[model samples]
Target: MSHARRSVLVPSVMAFGFAFLYVPILAMIGYSFNNSRLVTVWDSANSPTLKWYSALWRNQQVLDAAWLSFRIALLNATGAAILGTLAGLVLARFGRFRGRTLFTALTTAPLVMPEVITGLSLLLLFVAMEQTIGWPAGRGVTTLTIAHITFSLSYVAVIVQSRLAGFDLSLEEAAMDLGARPVTVFLRITLPLIAPAIVSGWLLAFTLSWDDLVISQFVAGPGSSTLPMVIFSKVRLGVTPDINALATLMVLTVAVGVVIATVLLRRQERRRERDLRLAAGAD
Candidate 1:
């Protein structure tokens, strides 16, 4: 196919896919206002009501779980971003050190490990720790965050390391030649270049922590519930229109975040391009 035709075809196909994916979500949101308990019906006469949302406001269980989820997500994501970026920098730049390959391999192993296995293993470890040390009385938010950080660190490390590999180290060398200290050069030059990678890693870690079910289920104890766990239990019991309401809110939140991130990335790319053009002109 011609390039023009391919472009059109690709967008058309993508548009169809997006529509297919999101239309159901839109319908779910519409159904949240549904006065009837049934999800399938769209009866306009008795259809529209904000009762579910109102009820959701008063739901202490859900509100508490969501608060805990957000807090854990932030902690896990931030911790993973810091530790992972440092590790990634060491691996990518330091190079060929003893046990480097072994550590790298071990770090990435979690990516392929089954969720059930990871969850079960963590659960067992927690149990053993409590038995031996008599601490962490039971699995809870702290334990859950630790599990999420374990996996998130691997993701963040891989992302930042990949970014560093393609980055221009000449900037650092140039700063040093101009009489800047190594630390000063790194703080002013290297950090900004890798900021995008760090942000992306943090976002991924946050989403993973928030959406995790299996590991949270295994590690969470009495009263320490995440949103996904609550939703899973609800689904297993039976379907409720309330679930659709909850799903609708989650979809909106995620969509807004993704859109904002994409816009910021595009803006950054444009700024970089403009700066490059200006530098070339100056020379």
Candidate 2:
């Protein structure tokens, strides 16, 4: 193809792809303001009102599910970050250790495993545990959180491992040469360098836990529904304006978070560049 035609064709295809992906989301957001009882039909006379948005605020079930999902996600993210970081460190730092291949495989197994199989395996494990030890007598938030962490930890580990792969080991060696203990060197040097990766992993884990449905459904008990579970149930009953409103609010929240994080990161990058330039000038 000619360069001119290729350029135009590429941009047209890109625009079409983006429109195909985002048009539905934009329509959902627009319909959230519909004032009519029937969500699918948008009547101009009664639509585009804030009635559903207001009604969503008073929805006790949705509120409870949101709160529960947030709490579980927070805990799952923290636990997954800690455990995954340790596992990643072991793989990255300790070379040729016994059972290293097995450990690596086990750590990453969930990344490729189907969600249905993972959920079913977890359900069976929980049932066996309850029968044998009488601990965790029933499936609930704790079990759900644990299940989320299991899968999320693998994602975190992958991120941490990638971050560690490009890390400069000389910094840690220098700290150790100065008589700093391994723990102190890690806390002072290694952790600081890998902080961004850890934070990214935490966010990834949180998103996974927050959006999980199939695994959560298998593990959750009565009255322990997550936001996704509630949304799924509502969707089955047919589209509702309140659900659309709720989804729009969630999209807005995530967009705002992305904007804030982008601004903060850009500021940090500019500051780092300025510091580097100042140091170079001084040298």
Candidate 3:
């Protein structure tokens, strides 16, 4: 093909692929405005209503479930971010001695393991622990958070490792050579440089924790139902209009956050490029 034709073909194909992928999401969003609770049917030819959105506010069960999900996600993501970043730093940078590979393997094993298996294993472990230690008392938010942390850590670790792999370490070396203490060098140079990766990892972990249903279902108990678990139950009863409204809201929030993040990242890249160009011109 001619170069012009190839360029057009590539962009056309990409546009088609993206539209195909997003059409369902767009349709779901549209359906959330349907006046009919039956869904899957047109609300009216002329209008869409925000009644479902208003109704969502009144849904105490959903509100509580969402609050619970948020709490768990924050706890799991924060804990996973710190713990996994430490592990990732060690494994990717300072790792030494035998069993290092084994530890690494175990850390990432959950990424490939079936969720059902992980859920079952964790449930069994929790049960065994309660029986043996009598400390946990019962499965609840704490147990669910623990389970989320276990699964989310792998994602956080891998993200941090990727960031560290390409990082320029001379900054830290220079800081240390300038008489700065080890902790000072780490705080000033290393942490700031890796902050983006850490934030990205935390967001990813939070997303995974929030989206999880199978694991949460196994570990969650009374008054500990997560948003996804509630969604799961609603889906089983057939997708209600209210559920569609909730899903639509979630989709919008996620889409907006992703778009904003992408824009910020691109803007940062452009700023860096401009700075480099200016520096080069000055030299």
Candidate 4:
């Protein structure tokens, strides 16, 4: 293709892609403010009202589900980050330990495994554990959190492993050479270098947990519904404006989080670069 034609084609395609992706989200946000009972039908005379937002606020069921999902997501993210970091550290740094291949495969099996299979297996395991040891009593928030953590940790491990693959080991070596213990070197030098990856992994795990439905459905018992579950049920009944408001609020929260994470990562990158320049100048 000619350069002029290619440029126009590229921009046109890009615009189309962006619109295709975001137009629905824009529509949802717009519909959240709609005054009509039917979400799609715009009531222009009484449009742009906060009625749905107010109704969503007063919805005890949604509030309970959101709180439950938030708590589970938070726990899942923290647990997944810690476990995944350890697993990644072992894979990246252990260097040909006994059963390394098996360990690595088992750790990453979830990435390729079907969610249905994973959920079913977890359900069976939980049932067996409960029957055998009389522990957990029954499925609830605890089971839901554990299930989320199990699947989410694999994602975090993959992210941490990828980050470590391109990382410099010289810093840790220098710390060790300076009489720092292995633990100290890891805590002081290795952790800081990998902090960005850990944060990214945590956020990804949180999102996964928050949005999970299939696994949560398998593991959750009575009165343990998550926000996704609630939304799914409500959508089956009909798409209401309250649901739209809820979704818009979720989108806003995610957007704000992404912005904050981007700013923090950029600042950290700048600080690291500045430090490197200063060290080079001193040397």
lDDT of 3 by residue, 1-283 (tens): 4687669889999999999999988888898888887787785963499889999999999999999999999999999999889878877677496888888898899898999999999999999999999957898988999999999998888888888887767767788889999889878877766677788889889999989999999999887899999899989978788888899999889888878877886787578669879997999
Query: Model 4: runs farther than 4 Å from truth?
Result: 1-5
Ranking of all predicted structures according to lDDT, beginning with the best and ending with the worst: 4, 2, 1, 3
List per-prediction Cα lDDT, in the order shown.
Answer: 0.87, 0.89, 0.87, 0.91
For candidate 2, the TM-score is 0.91
Task: Tell how far residue 268 is off in model 4, in angstroms.
Answer: 1.4
Poorly placed runs, candidate 2 (over 4 Å): 1-5, 273-283
lDDT of 4 by residue, 1-283 (tens): 4687669888999999999999999999999999999777899999989999999879999999999999999999999999999998888887898899998998899888888999999999999999999877799888998999998898888888888887868888888889999999999988887899999999999999999998999999999999999999989988888999999999999989989998999899899989999999998
Writing each residue's lDDT as its tens digit, candidate 1 over 1-283 gives 4687669888999999999998977877888888887767776898688777777789888889899899999999999999888878886777688999898887789888999999999989999999999877787878998999998899999999999999867888889999999789778987888898899899999999999999899999989999898889888987678888888888889889989998997799789879989998999
TM-score of each model, paired residue for residue: 0.89, 0.91, 0.90, 0.95
TM-score of 1: 0.89
Model 1 spans > 4 angstroms off: 1-16, 177-182
| Clashes by residue pair, model 3 | none
Q: For model 4, what is the alpha-carbon lDDT of residue 40? A: 75
**Can you rank all candidates by TM-score, best first?**
4, 2, 3, 1
- Candidate 3 lDDT for residue 109: 97
Q: In candidate 1, how many clashes are counted?
A: 0
For candidate 2, what is the total of clashing residue pairs?
0
lDDT per residue (tens digit) for residues 1-283 in model 2? 4787669888999999999999999999999988777877888997779988889789999999999999999999999999989988887777798899999999999999999999999999999999999967898889999999999999988888888888768878889999999999989987876777788789889989999999999999988999999999989989888899999998888778768876876687578669879997999
